[model samples]
Target: MAHCALEVADVFRSLGPGWHQSVNLSLGQLKVVSAIEQCRSAALGGHVLRCEGCAAIEVAYNSCRNRHCPKCQAAAARRWLEARQADLLPVEYYHVVFTLPAAISEIAYYNKAVIYGLLFDMAAETLRTIAADPKHLGAQIGATLVLHTWGSALTHHPHVHGIVPGGGLSPDRSRWVACRPGFFLPVRVLSRLFRRRFLEELEAVYHRGQLQFFGEHTELIDPGVFAKWLAPMRACEWVVYAKRPFAGPEAVLAYLSRYTHRVAISNQRLISLDERGVTFRWKDYRVDGRTRNKTMTLAANEFVRRFLLHVLPAGFHRIRHYGVLANPSRRENLSKIRALLHVALEAVDPDGDVSSCAAQPSFVCRHCGSPMIIIDMLQRSRPIRAPPPEQCHA
Candidate 1:
């Protein structure tokens, strides 16, 4: 793939130092900024590669490998998808999204670890709870939930994208239970349950002194005040909707490859960064058709601020598997399900195509398609500067 003329690294490298000095950022956010600025640059040591076919030589810089780095996720996504290919069931896959309202999103910014954890747990619970009901699917289902904290314009829109099979195993574990054709579960039922459980859990966390409030929300530190604030949200509808089932397992993989490891924005969406600030494309979901795609520009500092808003707390797993797909028993569950469905075991490469999931050499000869071998390591020419004391940890 051709590299984009502009990248997030370019934006960060140009504005990060000055912007960070003027703003307050968590240690995690600071690390993200620094990592993106130095990613694939001379600051990080790299290796020299020589092609076997044409004997072409090239120098490749190392990637920062930060989960939030746009340049790093493509490779990470490929590896993750390759692992997930084996778990694919020959059944319809449904896409479900659960979004926190704007009010809750503001609170999540301050309490990401707690609130985000609740979002995952509550979402998973909501699905399992609804699906297990006899009136509903009446089976145990598995889902892969991926959390995305940014909207098209880099706003703090915390949501989980769930990939679910159309059905699950029966209660007795004797047979496969499939969902209604082209439908997974009722969105309204899911939405109602999700809202009730999440808010209830959030209130409990607040009482336990696990949630923190700041700035305009400091008044929420009071128990009564917090309860009053959550009143509106309790009455409002939480967004939980499911899309049509995917055509096949291939389509499901294709969708996962795109959404599973995405950052706040991609390099391709960036148009230019100049004295006018950073201009980028965004989709206005409120609009229809081609008009939905529009470009907006933000002052450099503001752009960096918005981009950093999405840096997750350290050691948080943004990609999670729940219920039948839970990491502990996924392989065994899949084998049982395959048997119940009478799926024939076939010999197939988990990596699929060499040009796809399999890792490619860092460099290949342009003249002849041949592997590139690492010949030497390139050490950093200068000592790397340390981060500020406040931003040094995490």
Candidate 2:
């Protein structure tokens, strides 16, 4: 989690309003910008804390807690991982990615809600379908599919990362079906099935008038034109690849801690902001080893626009669980799976003690190492004036 000296919020604070006006931003994108600008600032209000031992005081502002805010996702990710800790099984986990082709992605830019949902549904279906085939694992598997819509350079590259247990339950529910060592399902099979299912579903949605096309894609409104557009995608290879299995369940948690809450870009990638542009590092997958992580500079407004390209539709879920891990049957399925694996059930705190779940460190006195205690409620009306220059720790 290496962070650059400058934060995305700093960029927003300096140039957000003008950037917002330069583009016709969606409601969700506007909300994200507003949150980033106001996050942890005097605008949102905060509290004053006093060191229990040193008598030194500090001000801490409130977080916007918007999911898309880079400044706010770290804690959100940690809390989410804590809750998911109990869900881990004593089994191997596999990482699989299903990515849409560039053609489909272009259309997705205009039809995010429909296409993104299709991605989740088809990705989950592909895994479940293939795993259930007798020629494959022949088991009913579950997956945690997280939708990511941006590439390294913040381009619209829609993909779903699936965290699936290396094995699953027997068709009869009588045994734990395990995959071959170091392998889950074949990527080739997954690609074909995913592409076919996705295109079929996309066509269904189009026929129902559920997908909208604008700009260059406006001609796709015609059924014949749309069919011609999709014909090539049907033959082209879809991108589906599986990474090596995670070391173990703990490794899975570590991976989830990073990916689960990530926004389009983290503040860590931002190197510097200047009159010329904002420079940030991005991995160039097209390049060979040693030069992949390259810096990219975009005009401030352009950077903001590319970042906003990923703002999701309102109430859209980017993270989802399917099959056994799905909400309705998760508890029961996990209980049965744990029993089959002979793992003990995690002890549940019936009274739900809130403190036990809080994993973050208590803010401490930098000089004396004693915990800080809230001393005063700071109202928004109180402008966040500078802390006494001699006393402030920043």
Candidate 3:
């Protein structure tokens, strides 16, 4: 069966070299483009397999495993989810989204490392601070925050999706405190605090010269101009909304699998590619009608430009845990929370017991519906191609 009718790799393979020849790009963007073009191909090497039932031979190529490659995220997400399975608490889970305004998005394009890092800190602090207030949940909660830098249609709209347990440990750390059913924290309270704290920290960064301005934003280099530019955003409402609690742990896991490793666009969204260029489906959240799910086609060069806009700063983390779920104290915190809630740990499977989920199937026989085994390993070789142009698309 075909994995996908159209793949992101195909688009890169067809247009990437040409795009590279025409524009200037950062080292990170260039690397991501190259990685996507080579993913799941012979250049990365493969395994030769033989079907046990019919002696059919098949070769499976290795994936580049780049964070920005659409083809590589599924495996990465599955591996991440497997590790997180044990971290699940029996309590309800909430989904909260913290979005950056368009005013800051322009600045973020040039100062990604500083701005994005600040966004994460402010978002986590917002949730923790509001939840700890006596008028709100009044406890210390844990959250898993994943950063997404693009919206549908590959536009630069930075946001964080937070997965928070619906309750927390009392200040004394001796009791389980749960929020009322279907609610987590007040959105208005969260929005106000998030906006105030974000602006305060942003001003500090500007004064420290931690941010850079380019193109139309060069005026922002002056402290007076920058402060005035930030004035209007202080009063505009920031988007901070929480969804209803998930059905249970399994539901939360299912949701996490979709959000944690998503790229600018997925293969499944592609509709067609022709002389007119690339067409894909995107949802317009600004609309409130049936026409929201619309098809957009961009010239080949524009499409590549939009895709490369989201390549994050190298070594900057996109997934993070905060508060009680912070990595250093996660295990001990979970143990204490479980005790307070009177919930037992998940049952362990003994040797020879059926696994909770099947091990990754190494292979499958297309002819006889049987499993395929690796019979031989292939060595990787550098791909031979025309020399890429000195200039690449931006």
User: Which regions of candidate 3 deviate over 4 angstroms?
Assistant: 16-18, 289-291, 347-360, 383-394
Question: Candidate 3 clashing pairs?
Answer: 20-392, 23-392
Model 2, span 234-263: residue lDDT tens:
889988999999998889999998899899
Write the number of the candidate with greater lDDT, choosing between 1 and 3.
1
TM-score of 3: 0.93
lDDT leaderboard ranking: 1, 3, 2
Give each model a TM-score. 0.94, 0.91, 0.93
Question: Candidate 1's error at 27, in angstroms?
Answer: 1.5
Model 2: residue 341 alpha-carbon error in angstroms: 0.6
Deviation (Å) of 46 in candidate 1: 1.1
lDDT of model 1 at position 154 = 99
- Give the C-alpha lDDT of model 3: 0.87
| CA RMSD (A), model 3 | 2.9
Clashing pairs counted in every model: 0, 0, 2
